[model samples]
Target chain A: MEGMAIRLQGLRKSFGETTAVAGVDLEIRDGEFFSMLGPSGSGKTTVLRMIAGFEAPSGGRIELAGQEVTGLAPFERDVHTVFQDYALFPHMTVEQNVAYGLKVRKVPKAERLVRARKALAEVRLEGFGKRRPSQLSGGQRQRVALARALVGRPRVLLLDEPLGALDLKLREQMQVELKALQREVGITFVFVTHDQEEALTMSDRIAVFHQGRIEQVGTPAEVYERPATPFVASFVGTSNLLEGESAHRIVGTPGTYSIRPEKIRVLKESAEADQPEHATAVGTVAEVVYLGDATRFLVDLDAGGRLTALQQNLETSSEDVAAYRGTRVRLQWHRRHAVAVPVPD
Target chain B: MALITRTAGALHRRPRLRLTLLLTAPLLWLAVLYLGSLSVLFVSAFWTTNSFTSEVVKVWSTDNFHELFTVPVFRQVILRSIGVALAVTALCAVIAFPLAFYTARVAKPKWRPLLVVAILTPLWASYLVKVYAWRLILSEGGLADWMLKPFGLGGPGYGLTAAVLTLTYLWLPYMILPIHTALEQLPANLLDASADLGAKGWRTFRSVVLPMVLPSVAAGSVFTFSLSLGDYITVQIVGGKTQLIGNLVYSNIELNLPMAAALGTVPVVVIVLYLLAMRRTGALSSL
Candidate 1:
């Protein structure tokens, strides 16, 4: 069995009257890329900070590598964090910044410099060590921050939205690079991010957080396919929620159900949906949004609700899909695609 | 009114003319009133004083500078002034760093501006009044002695130590302002990142906090050092027989104007050299 890298029991933090992380219990396996995915103010960052020992949990026990580390300072713990802003020391050269951890640990100067350079090379930043952080571009600075955190080789690396500042293209590129680096290093990576796509693409397992509590903990595919709660269904991706009359009329149920937009296919009103395992609804296409690679059709069903269906733009252009608005259409998906999610209080 | 409108239109059309007009007054003030007098001082420093009738003499000579360098009393006073300036700057830094850190980083945001105003309140008081207050405090059996009596200790009576103490108090606001600004602007995440990198509090302070705020410290020291170097009134009031370069310059103004100007150039030269050293540390860019 894989060892647990980090474990938290009843982790809670409150700033005065407002609670940031109400209660969290999690066990992150060693060498796994675990993510806490949530929207801003959902307490994901507070949880990450508490695990890193930058913040003291108001009521909880934190264990790192099976040793209780509750109330220990960040320096005393066996973890490191990559700040969102990069937080590269402006005064030091890139090498010195990466070597800071080793220097603090009383590592020999020559050995630390060698390890710093090796870490930099791992991030593809060789020979850039003499440059100051201000001299490097945004993406380069990000790699330097990554290298600096990795050079210490801590048991668990806590990253707090480290790519939040980068542009879309750079963020996508670094996401891949970070995933590969985590796999190569074989250290537990606990990534906290509000970007659902980032968490979905990089994390081995994800814990969806809402209002300071985990909504669900599962693999990315599981979280995406079978969301545990209504919040998770909407937050992780676009979900066409059906409830009450619509749920009864279309889904043949009287509870909340989440259907992924991509699962439903839009067809002409007269198109046959004869399969017994498929759920079909007749609706009018109220709006059509052209998304380059895909087209989103917002359908106002006659059954008393709106459903969104995504269709690939393989044989259609923007003008062609734009002409689909206000047309009568039929949306069909497999019956099992509509997952019943627990309604929130 | 038409002429005014035409002139404004013309100025708007020509950016260079507009900029020149905007800068003319300040440029004139800086060049003529400031640099003009400074050049006059430099030229007069090389001239000598007539000894026979004690009349004005503008003949160019290095006699004053020669005496300023050779004379034992002038050398002693010059060294003493520099020593006091350095001591005051060091003490101001040691005292102001924690106070400024508290005001900027530790204090609640609502109280920051009020704390800054409190630090600046002393500057509104008359300089002579402040010096005289220090004079009273440093007097035998005064506030200093009264405060130290419980510890079985007494104050260092009026002298160079008194001058350094008074100057440190006087120039503390100058030191605190820049350091406070720098500390306020320092990102909190850097501290967190430092700690996350396995640096303890003092290590983070030395590696992250100190280097980042050093330029501001140098900026503040400029104020404290130069001001302390040129101060003579505080010495006269509370310094108790201490003679600084400013005292020599003030005493020689009537009898030996050239000698006084030469004496004045010493602090200016020292300040220039100090600025060059600070610039090497990249302090000027932050300033």
Candidate 2:
């Protein structure tokens, strides 16, 4: 936990005509829960594989705990991967699967059994050791996979969409459990996922990727609130992008500007007579959507554009939410909340 | 046409009816033709033969069984047949594992199918032709002798060794195909997971690949063992004076059909017992 656990410089991979990971440079801190988030075919998984030494990078160097491990075999590297499919050996019992790494290291039989049981217990699976992997539930099998990887005590753990196969409720529950487990183990956990919400909830820092390149890397709040590019803003969360004349009229900016829906305020004409001090636009309400905990209003601005504003329910009834439709309301926000992002071609 | 279509639709609606229809032909053939003939063979084994006229007497007697158990030549031939079958199976497995692994896992994707075709190409030649070719290869001053001459050694001439070698070569595809299929069906990520768990290549092969493929290996051995046990032609072509149960059965078939029937039961019994023993080891479940 004292130095960088994983580092990649100029990592590139290509399969015939298509490039998967194109020149990725990254450093993961010791014991940090870092997430690589992207859509499918965005090369996030390839980058994770390169770090785990499963795929030799077409060009680059990978350093694990200050030692260069490029071109090394997966077992030779001080890293482990929790594959998306779990990949539990169907023929092996849970205890044997968990003890596999120990056995490979040539540990004594008694110690291997004891450590495997302890690792299984750490995953909250205590008496299910003798059962085969096919006999376990998907969630239980996932935990077995985690135990199998964790029992090896590698310097870093690389997960490639480890919970992508689980149902929503189980995935959410495992997300919390995985974050807690990483905290307990104090191992650098490099998690790869395409689900933005999953990355947001579990990661200490996240790298958002697009089309084989890292678009932005930051803390969750920073990436969500101040996205560095148009792709990050659109991919991370719901953002209303305003560019060209609209951005100039609103923020006096030439570049594209992104505003989160929740940051804009919908003001009624009879409310306190207060006005926005930074930026304001008057528009007629085009659509009003009533969520249980929040209300959304789509405003058609006088400048011939649409903007979305979200407001918390805040003791308001559904009737009030319905009344906002088709009425002219002022969409207001502070200038600081309007983040400028690079416009895509 | 409408009636036929309606009938087809009705049958499709009932899965059990469709399954019964699908299975009827094979079931009837197996029950009436194959098993019926086998039962006739088994019954013939119990009949007595008149030594004076060589006529078969349909009497229920254990005389044939007694000779099968008590005769020294019968016992020697039975044991030798089993030993040759077992040896051929073991040798085929030892050779097939590496070849199948290379074809299924190590060879490049483009080369895999080519390798499989290469392994199967030998099987396309007629069985008789292959055995005859091996006969030449094992004969004096043949290809095997010429190759071994550099080391100052000669070929193992026509005998049990030659029969074993020829049979192993002939039945190798049977072993390689099933094991290759098993290895191919294995999930690619499983190997990666083992390596990720810090298991080296050899350990992964021992712990994961070997166990998963055991069933397929057992399935392959069934082919090799049973086929080797029943083979008489290969031995006739390659075996000089050595006698197996198959050769004994062949020699007795025309003059003493009952004795040949009894001798034929040896391989059937041995194969059944072998299958049962393999089942005890959980090989059937894997298959």
Candidate 3:
């Protein structure tokens, strides 16, 4: 089960003049919740299609379960996909939608019902069998789509932004619910989404895509805390992008350096004793925003532009906006958290 | 905020209600003109016709319906009309389905416009002129005979067969466009979703594509069937003695308006029956 669930090697797709999915390569482990995260037109969906056998690659190969499935038809492959729109057969009831694949495979009546019942119950939708998809809410319909995909017992489940169409509250709930369901079933789920929070929340590992290529691939913490490229850094979360350079690999002004919003510390005149790693910056407070538990301040650097810093509002002194915003307050941070990356030209 | 103010606001809504009803005047006229007249005609079907006077006498009885079955020739005409309508509908659906699917699903951006223009060009030409052209082509020593001479598919051309061909050709665009509309509006992701769920070519069509477009198929076919049943020009011009309800109505209209109205109820009844049958197929209606 630790074998490669999907091994996409240099896959590419082009539509007439536009290259939708340029050369992309990645390997997903079996039973892992892997997410392909990218912006719109970043080829995440195209890669998902190639894995599902819906779109053939212009170049490169895909292997699933140790079998070269690059040229196989969609039915010939061992993959199931839940589309973003749910694509729950609108005309079909939840039970019939879940039973479609079994009927196609000519499964026996008793076995089909038993498997469908089990799959539906796994998604916590046991009593929704007789309801049509239109009668079901968006989240329920999405679960029906999940149940349909899982009922087939495919080797890999391709989810193309399955939570994108739900309300905010429902989407967040379903994300946790879907992650739990994935763990319960132990099926390799290849999820596609542009939502960075979603990928960070649920994925065991994520491949950040840009221009149809893997910009970076790692665990959530690795991708977030140690982004390898400018695109990955900015795509993961908000960062203060500053032009800096690296001399002898030590990182100085000339190339872009990412200072995480939380890494900045609001100081009085001297740095705290514990924050004595390196690369401290002194700036005056340009703007401050109070966000309940934490207050954020933008500090204008003497070298160039403004940098945002997030400070926890632990004391009543932090609430003094007149002392922070538009005031000459010093801010400093450690060097390890400020990683430098070359800007993409 | 008070009850008197609420009552005053409700009283001011009367003119808007009057305007809304006034806007429905044309629709009311159409309903009264079509439905009211058809209902009267259907009631007349229960009355018997006098054998000697050959006039329809208004009496409360089902004698005319019973007498309609007593003669084998009347049943033969009825069957011929039904057979022709059903044949036209089936032929149109078969010919249009693939072409419509290709236009909607697979055609390139530039090619779609060209294909649609080609399909619509035939409709822009005079419908009667098309019938006339077919009438000339189907006659003895006509274009069809000359064209088929090399292929050996000729014996001066078949009669009712030629009429069916002409009617199918005439209504082909009507059948194609609606099916094209339905197919075009069909979500591409649905087919993609079906494919990802282990449905191959035929299975995808059976499970996903066919059920979604069943309404369009029903609507387009009913239009072709009923239109062919009511069309006197194509069948009369191309067919010499193909005895359809259209020709039956045409023969009585000049000398006997009442008999023409009576015969008109045949195709109307057939269309109503077709629509009623279509509604039972579990497909949603957009009409």
Candidate 4:
């Protein structure tokens, strides 16, 4: 249907003997912000390249707006990509870089220039059009790259770690701006990033990739709270994974379970499980990590495994938490917060 | 030994003295020997040769330059030499761009060093040997004519064309190396970004690849143009009757030393002008 912007069925890619993307099936909805979150060598970028028609799938069908486009060249595909390196032409001015796609599409020079100016304004780079890409700062060049890709108004915009090069402060700022820009353009955005926080902050739905396959596809909350596999449990965020004897003793089940560190509460040694739905474990504090806004407590559980608990620094300073090291404490969480995950082969 | 150590300590403390000491020998060579001969040649261009006695007289005159600009044979040779240089440069560029692109981008990574070595192998042979080899190829019933005989066409025998061809062959490695380096340094992501933005292969090449490599091409052209402009031996070996500025200078060197120096200045002046033009294209900075 028209509601589906992109569809990949049994898509696969291999380089010589190495399989980069084994098999992937995905459908990105129209006007949705979708993210493929994975580590390096996990094949997330390869799939994005396939959708952009830069790499042909070894065995798959790629349909864009319900039309089969697996055999098309990159120029023939109605998609644009913002590269991680921000590959703006160094020879051209910012205006020329932004107007390049329109020029390729045979848009008249006058009209393309006006559209380029508008795109630059959208990225808040109105007066910087005449400057060369080399003259701009890293963040400004990033904005120019965005303006260049969006000037054509393609059906789907694929961004491959476009913000990965920036410093953390600028990256966070651009993340907010990019999300706002995606909403305003109402275009399908397939973002690929290794940073889970970036994916969670921007994507309406996230597909977590591991090895060469999709581990889970769901909303950020679902993937973080209820991971489908043990790999997804540890990758999406920090997780307290209990398995085998530890799982049976603490969770009352003989299987793997993932409980988020933020979900577990570090309490006084004499604390009791006040609610019937609470799961409690007693442990000695092994390590105390003082993050600025929150303190992390790593407890060596008597039940045979270690569990990490993140407590907000409300009334405690670094010295106060540092003194908690080697002290006895109780870790408690709602039983529902711990979800069962499948064991990896 | 104490004096040597004290001098060393003094040199280390004085950076300016150290830099001056480091540059003294090279500066002496460049200024006294290299530029010294060039200035002497320019100064002698103004002196005249005795017509009857055939002896050098230290009398300054503009007659050599006057004859250089006004004589029909001299003007024709100047123009023809410039034309041949331009033609050779153009042909080298036409051949080198694709060859360099393939060697730099399209070839397998393992083959790249081998291919570069192959290009450089031609340069290791003596220049005269290469030109003489071309001489045999362009001679009557040689390889070129023998190959073209099946097509009922004759080879371009020893002439301006033969001279240009030999010069292009001689200077091609120079052109290929710089452009190859530029292309190799070009990031692969720019090409992908171009295609991803809807530009096809040729369009990407024209708008992205060519502009970025123009400085390198200009750098290569400097070698090709100057080398072709001043060549006399290749023309003599394979040029048949073609007379370039080098031949004119060589012939006039003994009998008409002033005229020979004047004619030599023509190539130097042309090269200087060519360098100015290339500098406008931002080539010298890249070089």
All predictions: root-mean-square deviation over Cα?
1.5, 2.5, 4.2, 1.5
Q: Is the docking of candidate 2 incorrect, acceptable, medium or high quality?
A: high
Q: lDDT by residue for model 4 over A27-111, one digit each (tens)? A: 9999999999999999999999999888888998999999999999999998999999999999999999999999999999899
Q: What is the DockQ of each candidate?
A: 0.90, 0.80, 0.68, 0.92
Give the least accurate 10-residue stretch of model 1 chain A, judged by summed lDDT. A245-254
What ranking emerges by DockQ with the best candidate at the front?
A: 4, 1, 2, 3
Tell me the lDDT of model 2 at B77. Answer: 89
Q: Report how far off residue A110 is in candidate 3 (Å).
A: 2.4
Ten residues in a row with the worst lDDT in model 4 chain B? B51-60
TM-score attained by model 3:
0.90
Model 2 per-residue lDDT tens digits across residues B151-236: 99999999999999999999999999989999999998998988888878888888888888998899889999999999999999
Per-residue C-alpha lDDT of model 1 across residues B93-120, encoded as one tens digit per residue: 9999999999999999999999999999
Model 4, runs deviating above 4 Å:
B1-10
- Candidate 4 is graded, for docking, as high
Order of all candidates by TM-score, from best down to worst? Answer: 4, 1, 2, 3
Model 2 residue A147 lDDT score:
94
lDDT of 4 at A128: 98
Clashes of each: 0, 0, 6, 0
lDDT of each: 0.93, 0.90, 0.82, 0.94
- Residue pairs of candidate 1 with colliding backbone atoms: none
True contacts kept of 2: 0.97
Error of 4 at A116 (Å): 0.3
Off by over 4 Å in 2: A268-278, A284-291, A314-327, A343-345, B5-24, B285-287
